[model samples]
Target: MSQPRTMKSTAKKTTAKKASTAKKTSTGKKTSTAKRTSTAKKTSTAKRTSTAKKATAKRTTASKRAAKQTMASTTGTRATRTQATRAAAVEGAAAVPLPDFLASAGTLTLGQRKLLVDQALLILDQNYVHLPLKAAMHAVNPLQRLRVMRARMERQTAETMEPEWMFHRQMSSIFHSVRDLHTNYLLPVPFAGKIAFLPFMIEKCYDGAGEEHYLITRTVTGYSAPQFGPGAEVTHWNGTPIARAVALNGAQFAGSNDAANLARGLESLTLRPLVIQSPPDEDWVNLTYIGLDGSTQELREQWKVTTNLPPMTDLDAVSETSASMGLDLDSDEKARAKKALYVRDVVELEDGQSSAELKTPAAVGGADLPTTMPGVFRAREAVTPSGTFGHLRIFTFSVQDPVAFRDEFVRLAGLLPQRGLIVDVRDNGGGHIYASEFTLQTLTPRYISPEPVQFISTSLNLRICRRHKDNPAGIDLGPWFDSLDLATETGAAYSAAKPITPEDGANDIGQTYHGPVVLITDARVYSATDIFAAGFADHEIGTILGVDDNTGAGGANVWTHGLLAALLNEPPPPDSTSPYEALPNGANMRVSIRRTLRVGQLSGTPVEDLGIRPHETHKMTQADLLEGNVDLLAKAGSLLAAMPHRSLGVTTSFSGTTLTVTLNVEGIDRVDLYLDNRPISSEDLTGAPLSIDILEVTPGQSLRADGYKAGALVASRRRTV
Candidate 1:
């Protein structure tokens, strides 16, 4: 969403009219007259010319001088034109030619065809001048095409056009390939810098007739690290001595009779040590020696100590390296412990179904009540029949469930005493669009006066060319080479487009409690809330209240790519050897798509960055809420209550999971409540030491304790454990 405030306002009506009329008049008379006069003079001169013998002599003398001048001028003009033409020709030739591969292909697979078309469309849309052919090829591949294309496009369109795009792309590609290798290759390759091949086995397939078995094998490789004791002693593994070694090597595996058998064989030979110690600790060495199986033929072989271990680094060097890797020694240790606990808890949760029951002490009073109203509350002070004034109801939308937004709205509206209403959507974050639409429909009267919304049209360009042996005829490929068509425009245009006007339906306002309505909004209102605001502004059905400021105007929709590179490349600060480390690799992008135009007299005003500006503006601060200042809400309620001949009343009750408060007034209405001059929800009243519904009481007077006890108790009160 564009910031509504920053949007350029349309020219004033008077100025627009003057400019339009002036342009039309200027183009219509003077220009037409000038063109007609020029044509007339040329025709008159041609008619006057004649040929005769006596005039031949005079004509010859004049023709000779004229011919000489004409020849000189023509020669000069020809040379200039030739140079210009050649320059244009050279530019045309220098332009990037169409890809030879695409030109040669008669037909293509679905994937190939989609790739080509998408690439072409993207190029056309972006007008990229220096896209490399190799990069384009990579973008059209089946597995990686979409991801590559999106990345490339984002980089190309970035505001800065930073030179880091190539580097990022290459790094991302390498990381992706490495991840795939890890996932696909099941063989336990040593981290000793050796590339080891492990064979994969496929087992059995089931069919209705019987089970079928198949055998297959695949190899995988990677480098592996070594483990050693603190005293530079080799750890004992099985019966053989464990030596630290690093190498770059590859291997091949033979297929087995059955996939299961092959898998078992591979598992038997593979050695995957969880803890690889550098200069192995004494305890680690002892454990390794004890775990060794002397009976095993493979382990019984003697160990060869051909090469000595490399010299260990100093403590300072190790510390420096660890810091550069972004590891925190203390935090890493804590994280490892937490990970173990987390795994244990997850396992327990998964296995112990009965353990899910955790007993919690219930509270007395209204602590556990489900009748808590979940909607924005406003405070409005109103005068009663007895001349006493207090806070009253103004407007509220009960949004308990996103899907039931419309239903809640309808219920609230029906409960209102008067048809005239004011809806406060300030601070509303977005939810479901359907709910917003439903709310809008309910507010709209049955009868609608037809009006034109706007006009929508699109133009597409088509390219047609024919090659020639010499100079081919080149047509403009840009602009509208095809056709243009008009489509339905919404709002005013819808009414304008219709020819037959039907009799208006009975006004729902009369049937219901239709009265003057106002919509209040602020910057925090977004998404579905914004949509509702837009509808209200467009219909001219109500007055808007509040400042024109929207926080979400600049960011309507966003895209996020998760942490991968940050974890693998840019590790956390204070590097350590611990495997557990915090990784923060969150990135996001946001873009605005649609443009919003307020309707009625405000049609030219945008509600994108600049929020819907209300007819009346009021700013609410945090201090107001904390201190129990109800001035803003009270003002709104007073305005609504002042509407003529309106009876004001409020009904409070428990409705399943929510507390329902129906405040009705003959005209516009407002409601506000405060506890100890501090604002609180109805739910907060249940167990509070002091709570009062200021809306139902006289100004500066608190509700009596008896009234709180008499009200229906929906649930027991909650107390801190």
Candidate 2:
């Protein structure tokens, strides 16, 4: 698709009157509160009765003590609210109760339990990818099992069935049965808020022998200190081995990959609250750390509450990379990058001239370089080897209009020192499909045509899906269905576009660039990012580097619903203040509806379970993550420099059933020979491209040759014998 016209530039202005009024209102509230306190003190003094004076003084003293404790806790000082302290201060203040409202699952009526069971079953039936629900339900039909479980729960009293009791019991089991990572239950409570958290951030570390161990990279100040500090080796947690604890935590999110689940669990341990009426006793966490001297030190930890950190929804957010390096969390300016709309506006200069206005996008610590118009996306550029090579760090494929990205690429590609282009999407969470598709299409070479196809398939019947009852995104299926040519068994293939050729103008930014492309990928790539990775890998468009295992397997798009609201007959309004806000006894669930299929075939593998594998493998070490990926970038630069200049020669001859393949190569180091399009021989030609003789050559077999330099597949040719 061609780029669309840019949106008009109308500068936005903030109204200051409202701000001033709000400030006045806030000050008035503070004054009112102070006046009330003063009035109460005066009234107590005015009560001249001796008995009344003693009572007033006693109450005031108790209030002061409570305030002092609160202040100490907030300041991260060791303020122990021991049994003795509770007994001495604020007599009759009730101790926090166990089995809070959230745990009142057992209290639910039979009808409510049945309703929940039926709802869960329906969701699974309509959305889960492995179609023919019965077949997908291998061990035991989830629907039937849930029905039986609900029947059993129906017999229990409110006290026995705690809120989230069923979820705790069956959610992991249901998720584990399916391969969908995105399909899981959201607890029947507010997703965010104060909860129990371990005082330190934990990460998986590997030793020289490839043995796995957990390491503490960061300790929340005022929470965990000294023993659980950064760089400490975590040998155990709460009496459980570190590995075992990770496994147990992973079991809670059954369908997710171990790495993803473990990461999530650890993030929860340190950041997310462990939802309860009051914080779990901090002393419950018994941690044993292995010191540098090989001696083990055991310590009891308290559950700390945080009011600042947000939930860990992204992988990049959870990593304790910075803390381990003794760096502050706010050290990087990029940390402040928030979602924004960058309007392209031009401001007239006082010199009677108009140039594109240069307004820097607000980022945590981002730059504001002078440019023509602003952008919605965040990108950084660097040139090396005296401007012979260019590296563009594309933080995301998310943009207001994907076509704008293509235009940006056009501008970047046209720049000098375009000998190479390194595109980094290491932790991209994904956005619009068009953005990902267009970007990948622009990078791919023309000779590799007839791009691999993609499809979306659901276990539910298409007719039901089209009826729009279960359509969460409210996707318009009519236009989408018409655009695809059916592949096999509900597999829809995208319509083919005219093959891009060299005839396309050189100045065209949409056309493929001459330089080799190096793509950096990691497991965190999800949704559209995963799609781009799959296409890039299948087409052999570039050399992929980084851990390929964490490719998000959360199916495709997600649809969320409030279980409580739906049951109450008062579905939330279009702009409900809190879509996720739980009802008195309600919960929310986000389910995966369609599984994304790339290179679609009825029986072909889906992209959710099988992600793109990189040509070269690399992992982001703790140091790499903390240091802004300096090592990774340097390695990528070296690879770009090593890319061979495209110059090739090859001759194949058949002599008495023997095939002799000779090559003329420059700047290339690896040559691979294929028999009938299947690889037969590969050799490292570091010195020279030497002739090779194939002892056996079938009468009808053909020979194909491919050349690689710096891990990227550079050249290819085919010859019939």
Candidate 3:
């Protein structure tokens, strides 16, 4: 089994994102990352000093796990773990009273509560780019909801005001009503950072008869749900049927559609992102299920809170969240939790030992990849029942360098089996808008048409564009300014839709993987991933296979109050015109300020709420969950088998401004050659290895070739001199 290394999460140039926050914001400038300061940094230090201090006092569940591991390492014995397991069985794995903390901590005074509400309202009303679109699409008006909540709060006395739990829930729900994850009411400190979870995960799989069954697919090591482990079918959750419970739980989340809601709702059962969620109303859940031995089992699982999470410093979290973000709010924490379960606890690398119980199935065992960044890309040859083909799992596009990111992908695709390929972006939540768009051309054989972005026409929106038109470090909203300026007279609802990802960058690395490609996506695929999927479908880049009906549909660029604050208050005295103010008690807020529109034939369509639908859909089967997407791969394989096979490879050799282009082709009747996207020459091939040499082709210019199958274009390849 190949062990794919998970990069230690950080945003530093070295820490990862923040360190190399090259997540080019609107200005296309790489961000200077935030430090994980033991001591406060001067920027927003006074505002965050108390937050840093408050966070230290709590033991997030992961921290507790780490602490126990420290003790076990000191003892260096199996007995310590054995004792810990025993303790877990008697009480619960990392279980504690969550109500006590939520009920006590993060309680804001009435005046502070109203102030927070007002500021959030101001941001949403003034700058939220999706306001008009969301108003038309969803039933709940977020602005109206907030105002209603504020009105209710105004009449309450100190003793009668709703508890902290209700306050957070109400605030979170207003954002949820919009059904856009990018727009969220992040709870204050302790609650904001902690994640609530059960030890084991329950997944829904369809049996042979097409009946749905909930099974315990994974668990924290040593801690099973009582005597039951994987393969146990859960019958009930808190007295309600498990399936129905999932539906109810999912409604509280901000999933864009029913399919997304169900997926998210199911996940909420085991892992809840407290950053965007209130603590589970109940401290513990009574679960009843049928065990593997055909015996019925019942157990009480306590919800555990863990602070062992990814660092979400206000600016860093919000900056990345907005720019590279279509980011599922809880993606960082979810990634950390998943790593703990599958990588940290189960896989032992230092000793070079294997645990067969948890070993990955060979079909899903990623091939040994030699890339510097191993976490983002997973390469494997999937031997599905239909056939064996190259499987490239793009774990994320949320990386620091789009160039390095796409270059590595091109390299990996070249190394894999060239017959057919499965490009899996299942849970990718998106990062770096440019990275996602830049990556599109690598998969298809055409000049990628990037999805365009538009701002809701608002006076504040226009002002923001004007403020940063000259600042190169941040958003240079020059392109949209003229239209926005004209909107006042025209009474336009939105600024002109334009591609944020440059067309040159989008087509820069055109069609690296020429094999008939099938992209696999789930509801978790959002933001940047959404853009990628839309582009894939719009550009006719082979088939799309979905595990759910649609993608997460989070098609907007979000800005945290922090990112907005930085933009408006740059270089010297703060801009008095800026509407942002620090929230009370380290609370934060986010809103999608730019909405994305689909391109190509689906032109002018908003990607939000209406995400890309797949060409084919597969239901999750028992084999899929237990055996590394076996069924899903089979579906992808079958699709790849039927798709047309065509290949085009461009190799360039330049001699003194004269460029020689060599084409290695199959299934192509004729080929067209282009120099820097301009048509230079053409060839009608008859069983020939065609060569096109063009004069006056300068160094550093791009050479491209397109293959035609009987007059219709079929394949393309691009290369730089």
Candidate 4:
């Protein structure tokens, strides 16, 4: 798919805008809450969510605090009897009882448990890509765990197994231990489409003096908390310190690293996907906070359940590389329920530009972006310490059309400030592989070499590939067949590295923005987002500015069990491999079938547990949260100001069949031209626009120009006539 007509223009002087510094907000907060379960005690313990020991300790803590918060019926400001008595309506929603809701759930028989375990074992042993790496990095080996599970089930005399949630939890924990988000045990029914959340969200930001404070960033609209809202600082969770609570929560379902764990932990404090795991341990929580006006208060809120907002479904769910990076599925639309989930989201950008005018669909950041557009791309004309530039926040790369996505970004980039651009993918949970890699070429002049991926070289994986090689309805596994076959002789743990993102799609859209581009990332950036960041750094597009030390580092192509059942089967006449059986109930799972490897200097290195570290780290400040990221942008702008300014422009004119190529350039010392990917000419710039004439010219031919600085290629341009 070709891109939209490329925007063309000469290098224009960057216009500086007056920097506006809004008052920075810090600490102090409380919030309005949701439906209180009729019996908070009954709902306190979610089956499998908290261990028996933790549950007991939590119950004890609640009992001690039960007296302190006896005035829960009143608002945080100590509401009057009349104010407390005022009625609030909750439409189409129910107050569900807690642990009972899970305890009463259907149970899985011993046979069913075995089936699930066996399926996981086969998938992990034969198809899982990061087995060797994960085995080395993580203390617990999933394969070993599966084997132990199989042993327990095989020898046990009991006909019925634990409750369905327990069984799922055990399996889920096994997958989580690997610390790969792409691979997950998705529960069925009641849980699959449900989300468990609180009415308010919390976040951490550093004050000007570098003190860390946790505050209520936003609350669910119309929840009616007059006592507190944004800017409320949280000091404790239940009876534990807020940071300690976050860490405890993270220990339950954290990702690859400490940063990822803390991030996931913080996100889970407010919202959790029932599809991925059971609800929180407690049906309700008591948040101790300092109100914005210097008043201390305790806000006790109940956990609410909702299905109003569903994650955006994959555009092409049946594709080979499509994935679900856990069920907190993000979407372009800001549905009401989604708002509740993202109130404390790391980045939330609002786009006001019309689809037609922005020529794009976009995404993030807590900033109110001007000249806004939303879909996957949201841009604004930003003013910072270094003047003005475009701030483009990419919420996710999970798009249906890569070409259209790239073109839209190109269009949006052209319309924003041309001086410099800050591309923020903070909290972006990655979507399409092609979509992520395709956009990389647009920001850079260097070749966009999509990250390479490899599968573990095992017999089961080999057999599936061999059997499904000829099945047209299934995936194209022929590319990895030869390499897998050579594994025995070579003794390589993984197959040869190959890019899942086609080279053409990766490089089809050439550089569009000429100014310096900086990428803003956090630990939540995962899967395809990780791939994108790595490519950006590898290609030397610009300096990477990270709010966290590293990204989520979920580097692999994932496949759901359903997709596996369809493609990896060996039907009667040879349909894809049919090894996996019908799982009991509606249970399904996902596995990382191929592990991605870093290119360029880090070539051959796996990106499983280790994500791309930032070239520059930014400690998010209170100004970033309440003042539209002024400090973060200021730091970014400063970096952009110091980088060398470069440009490459080309035009073709013909005189009597001779092609005269005119080039206007800056900063770059040399330029090389290629026709149909073959070298055509080379020139050394002399600070003057140069015209190179070719004796043989075709009506239409592919043309490429490579720009070099300091003996190294820095930028590239492609054209056809």
Q: Which structure among the candidates has the greatest lDDT? A: 3
Poorest 10 consecutive residues of model 2 by lDDT? 22-31
* 10 residues in a row with least lDDT, candidate 4: 347-356
lDDT of 4 by residue, 335-362 (tens): 2234323332211221111121122233
Q: Which stretches of candidate 4 lie over 4 Å from their true place?
A: 1-104, 154-160, 311-318, 321-373, 470-474, 570-577, 654-660, 678-680, 691-696
lDDT of 2: 0.43
As a TM-score, model 1 comes out at 0.28
lDDT of each: 0.26, 0.43, 0.69, 0.67
Our model 1 lands, by Cα RMSD against the true structure, at 35.9
Query: In model 3, which regions exceed 4 Å deviation?
Result: 1-104, 225-227, 311-324, 345-370, 650-662, 676-680, 691-701
**Could you give the candidate ranking by TM-score, starting with the highest?**
3, 4, 2, 1
How big is the positional error of residue 71 in model 2, measured in Å on the Cα after superposition?
42
Candidate 2, residues 1-721, lDDT tens digits: the string is 1111222222333111110000000000000000111112211111111353353354345435533543344244212223322232232111122234233234445555556666666666644444343244334366566677767876777566655553444654654455444444444443222233443456664544656666665442233333234445676777788888777665553323555555544444443332212223233467766643344567654443322112112111111110001100110111111110011121011011111112232322243222222322333444343234555555444332334445555555545245667777654655434445556555643332222322234323233323322333222233233223242444542322221111111112223454667788765555557766766776666678765455544335434444222322222233243222332344434454444555423224566655666677655444443334555666676677776445446788879888888887775788788886678899788657589999879766766666787877666555567
**TM-score (all chains, Cα) for each model:** 0.28, 0.54, 0.82, 0.79
Ranking by lDDT: 3, 4, 2, 1
| Model 1 segments more than 4 A misplaced | 1-403, 416-422, 441-518, 547-594, 603-606, 621-623, 627-629, 645-721
The local lDDT score (0 to 100) that residue 223 gets in candidate 4 is 52
Report per-prediction Cα RMSD to one decimal: 35.9, 23.6, 12.8, 16.4
250: Cα error in model 2, Å: 2.7
lDDT of 4: 0.67
